[model samples]
Target: MIVRGKDITGPLRESADVCIIGSGCGGGASAKILAEAGKKVILLEEGGYFTSRDFDGTEGFAYQTMYQRRAGQSTEDLSVTVLQGRCVGGSTTVNWMTSLRTPEFTLDDWRHRFGIEGLSAKDLDPYFERVERYLNVKAEPDENHNPNNRIILDGARALGYSTKANGRNARGCVRSGACGLGCPFDAKLSVALTYVPDAVKSGATVYADCRAEKIEGSGKTKRVAGYVLDNERRTTKTDFVIEAPVVIVSASAIHSPVLLLKSGVCNSSRQLGKNLTFHLTTAVAGRFERIIYPSGGIPQSAMCDEFLNKNGDNGGFWVEAVPVYPALAALAFPGFGRAHRERMREFPHTGASITLVKEIDSVGRVTVNDHGRASISYDPGPKDIEYLKQGVAAAARIHFAAGAKEVMTLHARPTIIRSEGEIERKIRAASWERNSLALFSAHPLGTCRMGNDPQNSVVDPHCQTHDVPGLFVIDGSVTPTSLGVNPQITLLGIAEKSAEWLAENFAAVAR
Candidate 1:
C-alpha cells in the first residue's frame, strides 16, 4: 500500500526484508523486482505523490511541486542549472521522454577501464530488451515531429550529417508538448504510471513525503531513519524508522552520496562522492520566417548524433531539439530589458536545439554542507569548452541551412548569426567562461560509481557497496561514466540486472 506521510502522526517504526531509499527509475524498478520476488519491501520517497490529475501542464505548478529546489538547483557556483525531479516519480516524470540505450562503447570502456564485469553490451542486452518492451519504447514516426524537431532533422540532413528520430517511452501521446512540465494527458509512461504502481500492486509498501535522514546499523541488520515532511510547509511532521536486512540507495547522483555521508558509512575508499558528470548542455535558438509553434508538439522527437564520440576520443556532443516554453526561454535568452522583450516576441517563430556534451576531462564532486544539504562543484575542462564552441557553431550552421533567418547562442553577450558565413566568427568571439553562457544539465551521473576495485569505486560490479554487507546503490549514481544519450532506459536496465541478482541471492544478502 502507498502511504502519504501527512496521513501519519508521531513517530512510527516498521520492518521489512528490504528497504529502498528512493522512488525514481532505479528505486521503482528495484521495488517492483524485489516485491515480485515475494520479499517484504518498503520504499521511501522524499517527494509527494501526484498523479495525472495533479499535473496541470503549467510550468509554475510543476516546477514548484515536482522539481528539485523548484527547478532552481545548480552548482555551488550557480553556473549550470541542474534540473532534477524531487517528487515521488523523480526525473522520469518530468523528462522529455527521450529514451536511449547505453552505447556499446561506453559499456566497453567500463569493462576495460573500471573493471566492471558482467555488464557488457551483450550481457545487458536482455535487461535493456525487457525494459524497452515494458515501457513501449519506440521511435515515433515523422508525423509526430514538431517544427523544432524538424529543424534538427532537415538541417542535419542538408549538411550531410546523420540524424534520426529519438526512441521515446510513451503511449497515446497527444502531442501537447508538455512533457517537460509533466504529462497531464497520462500519455507518457513515466515511472509514476508504470513501475511505481506495479511495485505497489506487488505488495510493496511505499511512503511518499518521507525524507531519509540517515542510515544506521551494520552487519546482518540495518535501519533507515528519516522524517515525514509536510510537503507544503517544509516542516517535519513525524519521524520513522524501518529495519531491514538489505538496503539499497537509489537517491540519485546528487543525493545518494549525501545520504551516505550523513550515515557515515560506505566511504572506506573516500570515493563515495567523486567522479560526478553532467551531460554539460547549452542551446542555440534559430528564428524562422514563419511561426513554428515550437511548444505544440513532441518536445524532443529527433536528434543529430554525427559528432558523438568524435575523433576516437570517447567524448563528444550530440544535438537535439528542446521545448521552447515561455518562462524557460526567457531565462535562457541573452539580453536585458527591451532587447530581451524583443527576443521574447520571437518566441512563436523560434526553434531551439541543445548540444549535450559527453565529458571526458570534466571533473565534478558532490559534498555535504554544514547543514547537511548537498553541495556540488564542477569544472568543465578546456577540451569540453572547445567542444561546446564547436557544437554551437555546428548547430548554427545547421540552422542557416534549414532556412533560419537568424540564429543566436545562449551566451550572456549573445552571438548572433544572420548568415552562414558569420557562424564561426560570431560563436568564436563569445566568452566561454563560466557565467558567460546559459548551461543546463538534466542528466547528472556518477557520484558513487561502480567498479571492481574498492579503492577506486563506491559500489562493486553488482552495485553492492564493498564496505557494507547488505547495502547497494541502484541509480544513476552508479554509472561509472557519462552516457552519450538519455539515461532513463539505461538506469532501468541497470536496476533490473542488479535487483534481479539481489532477489535471486536473497539468502546470501540477508545473512
Candidate 2:
C-alpha cells in the first residue's frame, strides 16, 4: 500500500472516501483509525520514505533527506531555528522519542479560556493510553539510565528540584545514543514503524514524496490537488488529484496554515496563521571532570518542571538534558573560531540541559510569500525573556550541584560561569533576546487554533474548519496554546479522538 510517488508516470488521479494531507503523528493516527473504521483512506506525504537502512546517523545526510528546507528553516530574522521533519513519519522520525501526555493544566486552559469543548485530560486519557500502546511507549528504568540522563536526575535531585521521568516510544531500543539522526536499529518506534504500517494493513495507501499543493472546491465538495516530487532531485515529477468528500490538513504548525491560505479555504476567522507559539528553549552546557560521553546515552531521560509557571501564569518552562550529538552540539555552542574549537575539545566532558518555556503571548505569525512558501515572523513575549533568564540560572545551579567545573551559555561577554553565585548575576546582566543564547525548539504550535467560535478560531472542537464543512485540520497547528512539555502524545491523542468523530459522522460531514 506504500508507493514512491516518483515511480508513477503522468497525472496520477485517485479518489478516496477521505484524504489526509500529511503522514506524521496526526495524519498517521487518523489513517489508522479511519482505515480501521473501513474508510478508503489515502495518506500523502511531501517527503520520501526511508527505512532504518537509509539512516547512517550523519547530520549532513539526515538534514539533507529528512529535515524541512534541509533543516535550515528559521525565522525572518534568522534568530530562531525551527527543526521540523519533512518526511513520511514527520518530526516523530527525527525526534528524540520523548513522549508525554498533555498536562491537565494545558487542557483545562483550552476549555476555560479558548471556548474549546468536549475534551479534557480525563477525556483524553484513553486516547493517550491507546497511542502509547500503539507506539510502544515505556519509561526508562533506573537500572538502565544513560549517563547524560543520570546527570539530569542527579543534578535536579541535589538541588531539590522535582524531576519528571521522560517516557519514550521505544520497544527494543539498542541505546545507540543517536535518536535525533533517525534510529538505525529500528528500536525507536516512530509513527512510520508503528502507526503507518498498521494503517497500511487496514487498507490505507501512503504515497511518499507526494505533496498536497492546494485543495479545490468548498463546503461539502472538497478535493485535494497536489503533485509528487522526484525523490532524488526533489522536483515535481507528476501531478496528482485526490478527489474526496473529506479533506484533512495535518501539516505542522507553520505549514498547515500556509496550505490553507494557499488553497483559499478555511479563512473565515482570519486566524489561519496567527498566534504561532514555539516553546522558546535555551540550553546551558557544563564541563564536568568525569568523562560522561554525553553523546553516547539517552538524550532526554529526566526533566525539571519546578520553575514551570513560576512567573505567575504567563506560561512557564521545563528543564531537561539536550540529547547530545557532536555535530549538533558543536554547532549549537556559542561563538566560532578558537573558543568553539576548545569547547568541542571538551565535548567528552560536556553535559548540557535546556529550558523549554511554553509561550502564550507571542506576537508571532506565519505568513506566505509570493511563491506560497511559509515564512515566520515571530517575536517572543517580553515576559518570556525574563523567564528564560530564570530557567537558565536554574540549569546553571543544577550543573554546579552535580559537580560541574564550569558552565557555558549563549551570552556574548560573560558566556561562561565558574561559580553558582554568578548564575543569577550574569543572567540578569545579559540581554535576553533572540539569538543571545542559541535557542532551539522541537515544538511549534498554535498556527490554526481550535475553539467554539469561528471569529477567533479556525477549527471547531471536532477539528473541522468552521468555514469549510468538509475541510479539517488535525495537527499541532490546531492547538489553542503551547503545551508546557513534549507534544507528540497530545497531538496523537487529539488525532485519534478526532478520527473517531469523523468516522462516526462521515455521512453527515463528508458528502
lDDT of 2: 0.86
Question: What's the count of clashing pairs in each model shown?
Answer: 0, 1
Off by over 4 Å in 1: none
Candidate 2 residue lDDT tens string, 1-511: 9998767878888889889998898899999999999999999999889899999988888889999989889888878889999888999999988899998888888999987777898899999998898888888889667767777788889989898688999988878886888889999889899889989999999999998889998655567888889867977888899988998898889899999999887888999999898898888889999987887767777788798766558487888888767877776888888978888899889888888888866677898988889989889777777677778888888889888999988664437889997787777777766666677778999999999989999999999999888788999999999899899999999999999999999999986
lDDT on C-alpha atoms for all candidate structures: 0.92, 0.86
Give the per-residue lDDT of model 1 (tens digit) for 361-392: 99999999999999999999988888888888
* Candidate number achieving the greatest TM-score relative to the actual structure: 1
